[model samples]
Target: MLYWLMKYVLLGPVLRLLWPTRVTGTENIPENGGAIIASNHLAVADSFFMPLHVRRMVTFPAKQEYFTEKGVKGRLKKWFFSGLGQIPIDRSGGSAAQAALDTAIRVLRDGHLLGIYPEGTRSPDGRLYKGKTGVARVALEADVPVVPVAMIGTDKVNPIGSKMWWPRRLEIRFGAPLDFSRYDGLVGDRFVERSIADEIMYSLMELSGQEYVDIYAARAKELAAADAAGVRPAVPAQPSAPVAGDAARVPESKAS
Candidate 1:
């Protein structure tokens, strides 16, 4: 009731006027069934904007910090996020990933739409990183289709470190649902899980047009920091540089 009330009464009008989002391929989402809406994480606004365009109430696994504030401000924050159907997740360390996956699977088994960002966190530089295999695990375990969603222009509305929001046009593009029935019986194997996750990331790459990094989010952060510091140590030049005479004497290999 709270979700619908807020959607229809409060947020609906404001979002309609302010953002005025355009969503394509919304029909690609299953009307009433268990499905995972996997999207690229660009900015915080991605969460609110994506849900506004969808007909169904999409529940996302929000960090537990959103629900664990103190005093009146805390209470209000919890209420607002909760009203949006976000499940508070305790993302501390080690076991946190497994716990989140468990909760997500439960949501799917109950025949609900679960919204997850495969990139794990918001893209600091707006480049898409490699997706964690947890998404593939949930889809394979729950036996559902993973809808690849690409959100464009949201970073401009509310960027990573901005306190105020600007008026920017947002576009939500929902790609066709990806099926993993071919790997039905191979869910537990780590190799298979990684392969499926790569496939999903590939689809998202085409949708979002962000640079693809083979590493996960944590390592990406480290690399980004190093790059920012200008501490990239240059490698020594190769000692096997060919002379002009050697280049002319070299034989060419046969083309395949």
Candidate 2:
């Protein structure tokens, strides 16, 4: 009821009139059954614009803080986001990551479109960053297709720290669905997981035409913070293991 009111009666109509949105390749999104909507993170508005145009209800795993705020303004935000079909989960890492994965799995099992930003955070410089393998793990565990989406010009719609969205044209492009059937039953393999994630990122890179950076967005932000703090950040000697949300799945399998 709230979803319908927001989409048809309220915010959706207002957004359509305000922002000129262009969408393409929507046919790539399956009309039914479970699928992952894996997209590049841009502005926070990316979440709003994607679901507004799509016919299916797209649900995202949002940080709990969005729903847990205090005061009247916070209450309004909570209500608005809940109506937007977002579920709150802890994103602080470790067990919280596992819990988030569990929630996403539940959403998929219920035959809903699960929207995730494999890059974890928005790009600091509008370039595509390395995707976390958690998306791969989710798809594998849920046994669903991964649909890559590209949202262009969203960063300009609502810039990094802006409270209000300025009118702008945004593009939402959906690429072909990614099939990982050949690697079916190999969910616990870290190498295979990274390969799948890389393939998805490659597709998104092509769709968005953004320069690709091999580092995670989180790491880049950390480095940027360190630089501003006038402290040198230590670079890891080797790429850390892909500790995605459900890495325990790896231990359940016998090492080959």
**Best by TM-score, which number?**
2
lDDT of 1 by residue, 1-256 (tens): 8777777787777977988788899999999989999998988888888888889999999999899999999999999998888999888867986898899999999999999998889877677777887898999999999999999998999988997889988888899898887767767766666666777777787887766665666666776677678876322122122121112322322100
Clashes of each: 0, 0
Show the lowest summed lDDT stretch of 10 residues, model 2.
237-246
Best model per lDDT: 2
lDDT of 2 by residue, 1-256 (tens): 8987898889999999999899999999999988999999988998899999889999998989999999998999899999998999898889999999988988998899999999999987787888998998999999999999999999998888889889998899999998887678888678778777888888888899887877899888888788778896643334433332233444434323
Q: TM-score of every model?
A: 0.87, 0.89
Clashing pairs in 2: none
Cα deviation of 28, candidate 1, in Å: 0.5
Off by over 4 Å in 2: 230-256
**Candidate 2 whole-model C-alpha lDDT, 0 to 1:** 0.86
